[model samples]
Target: MDMQTINTFLSTTAIELLIKVGAAIIFWIVGRWLIGKVVTLMQAAMNRNQVDPTLTKYLGSIVAIALNITLVLGILGYFGIQTTSFAAMLAGAGVAIGAAWSGMLGNFAAGAFMLVLRPFKVGDFVSVGGITGTVTELGLFATTLLTPDNVYTLVGNGKVFGDTIQNYSHMPVRRVERTAQLAGSVDPLDAIVRLKAAIAQIPNVATSPAPEVNLLDFKLEGPVISVRPYTHTDHYWQVYFDTNEAIARVGKEAGWPAPASTQIHRVTQA
Candidate 1:
């Protein structure tokens, strides 16, 4: 070909390449911005609706990542890069990764269910997967809990869902039991009356159920007093400790002596 024709061809080819590159860059930027806006809007909605913040954040991140991947692929296609072989390779690798990480995927699915069903929430005390504690964090694969003694535990989401869950904090009320031993000489009726009065005085102890005392047995040993009272779940520990103290005090004032074995053999020998 002549120099004029060859130069013209080269210039046209260069202009076409520049246009394609510019279009690809614009697509990437515009796609990214649109994805960002969508993520922001969705996050606002989730917050307004009181959805789990961790879940919202994770979902938003995943969505943004997916959009970026799609934009990158679209840009590559615009630049005349074939994607069929790349897509096949991606599919094969995805299947292999999925097979290798099946357990993790199950956990992720269970975590998603937890977020949607909301059987328990952050700060709620629950027992599941053989672990009990106040939920501190909810993640895609595991949940973090703070135990009663302040120890931290992480439970796999799949195990948690697969096992039975005991949500002690879901209800507003729980029962507290207090047991005491009173001297057999003490009148059972009087002991019961005083014990009930003392339990009633305890703060957070529920009155509707009415605390009751049962005479468990009477042998050579003193009377076994079984006391049970209902209280608000949140105040379970407070009511339990206070009620026990109150019952013991009431028993003392009611002339219920402490349990002691009598020394009768020495007196008989004398």
Candidate 2:
């Protein structure tokens, strides 16, 4: 071909390529902005309807991901790329990834089921996946927990769902179990009365069901008294410590002897 013709063809191709690149950039920026706005609006709407915050945030994330994927496909189509073939390829890749990362997929599925079943929500004090803590977040693949010792933990949703879930905050009150050993010489009935009175004075103890001070069993040292106090989960630790103090105080006031194991030695005579 002539140099002049070649130069003209090159110039045209360069201009077209630049235009396509510019359009693609604009499309990407516009698409991303639109996706953000859509997600925000949907979240706002859910909030206005008083939807659960956890579910709203989860749905927002899912919608944003789906919208972003659609936007990318649209941009590809605009560039004259066959999006149908691309989508088919994406599906094939997803299957391969799902097979390789089956645990992740299981966690995702478990999260969806948890959302629907409503077993527990964010901020609930629960024991799941062998970890006892307050739920910080119920995410797409994992559940975040802030433990009693202030440790942050992440448990896979699959494990959480499969394990036994203990929701400590579900009930209005929880029973604190404690035991007190009295000396063999101490009157069991009198000790029970003193303990019940002391436990009743402890702060945050539930009044309806009342505290229970019952003789649990007899050991070599003394009779065992079960000291059970009902209190709200939030005040459990406080009440637990206070209950122990009360037991000590009652024993001191009654001047009860310290519990000791009794043993007897028999002397043989010839």
Candidate 3:
């Protein structure tokens, strides 16, 4: 070919290439901005509607990912690429991915079950997956737990859903049990009465059922008084400690008499 023809060909090729790249760049930027706006708007709506936070976050991520994929395909189409065929190819790849990560997919399935079954929620104390803690975040694949000592644990949904789930915060009321010990020499009935009185005075202790104080087991040192108190779930720890303290104080006021039997010898016997 002659120089003139070659120059014309080069010029046309450069312009076409530049246009494709510029179009791709513009689409990429605009698409990203739109994704952000959509996610932000959806987040606000979810918060306003009181959607479960975990589900809301997971749904927003899925939407953003789907939109971004669409944007990429559109950009590819501008470059004379066959996105329809590409999508079919992706479906085949997806099957391979599912096969490779079957366990992960199982976790995903379990997570879906948790969402539908509603066994627990954020802030609920639960025991699952051989661990116990407060549910902090529920995700599509795993659940986050915050233990009593401030430790964070991530347990797979598959394991969590497969095992027994103990939700301590499920009930409105709970029982708190403690024991007050008195020397066996003291009258059991009197100790029981005073211990029950002390538990009743504690704030938030349930009154309808009343506190039950009974003579239970006997130890070498003293007689055991079982103190069972009822209270709201939220006040469980508070009531537990308060009732214990009360029992100790009441027993002390009556005197901590030594157990019935003891041995003593006189040095002057000889």
Best by TM-score: 1
Candidate 1 is scored at a TM of 0.81
**lDDT of all the models against the reference?**
0.84, 0.92, 0.86
For candidate 3, lDDT tens digit of each residue in 101-193?
999999988997787678998889889999888899888799999987889999999999999999888986678988776775888888888
Give candidate 1 regions above 4 Å deviation: 1-9, 182-187, 215-223, 257-270
Q: Which ranges in model 2 have alpha carbons more than 4 Å from their true place?
A: 1-45, 67-84
Tens digits of lDDT, candidate 2, 159-219: 9999999999998999999999999999999999999999998989999789988999999
Predicted model with the maximum lDDT: 2
Clashes of each: 0, 0, 0
- For candidate 1, give the lDDT: 0.84
In terms of lDDT, the poorest run of 10 residues in model 1 is: 261-270
Better of 1 and 2 by lDDT: 2
Task: Residues 14-35, candidate 1: write the lDDT tens digits.
Answer: 7888889888888878898899
Deviation (Å) of 170 in candidate 3? 3.8
